[model samples]
Target: MGLVVSHLSIDCTDPNALAGWWAEVLGWERAWDEDPDDDEVGIRAADRSAEWLFLKVPEAKAVKNRLHPDLRPPDGSDQATELARLLALGATPVDIGQGPEVLWHVLADPEGNEFCLLLRTPAQVRADGD
Candidate 1:
């Protein structure tokens, strides 16, 4: 049998708070049935791609993230629009030496975790059967 991913986990200083922020950003809901002050929190996608598991850790992020999620705009939306909305949700632009040569916008979540807001390519749109 092939291996399957149960969830994507993130280590943070505050699990509940970070989960809340991501939930708002991704339109996901809390999947954990724990107290508001729990050291671990979960956020799940409506389509069930995979849930995000956030666990509280004592250490802070000190370097660039090796693995980051790249988000594509929904069928009806564009990158610029989504980027603006994410900015309103506390995402900040991060310069990680990806200058003008790159097409993706590098942004960091509230916890300084780097993620990319990718430009939707024709392939993705076509694959969506648009």
Candidate 2:
């Protein structure tokens, strides 16, 4: 009676380069290869905890992303700690019109896909835009 997400797929200009960037972020390894002759990469979280797949696409991104993922440190961890870690790993800050008081920091990968670092768990996100 419940639908579960098996994996998250992203379209990128370079699969291998994007996959490598994500692998460093999630501490994941290559899970599988979708094609041998073509470039499609699957990067899975360490211990197979989750999956994120990157596929090579021809079209360039023209507008903001409609959906994005938020990465949060495990329970009891603080956002600043994880933010520093991710920045050191090559993620750059993205100006998404959010203010300093916001609970999440927007960042872009090497290829410009926008993702966020959340200060709280999904259930703890403030409902009101206060």
Assess every candidate by TM-score: 0.90, 0.79
Off by over 4 Å in 1: 121-124, 127-130
Q: How far is candidate 1 from the true structure (C-alpha RMSD, Å)?
A: 2.4
Q: Which stretches of candidate 2 lie over 4 Å from their true place?
A: 33-38, 75-77, 121-130
| Worst 10 contiguous positions by lDDT, candidate 1 | 121-130
What TM-score would you give candidate 2 relative to the actual structure?
0.79
Candidate 1: Cα lDDT at 27: 89
Residue-wise lDDT of candidate 1 within 1-130, one digit each (tens)?
Answer: 9999999999999998899999998889889675767988999998888799999999999999999999888777888999999999999999999997787899999999999988885568688897
Error of 2 at 15 (Å): 0.7
Instruction: Return the TM-score for candidate 1, rounded to 2 decimals.
Output: 0.90
Q: Which candidate leads in TM-score?
A: 1
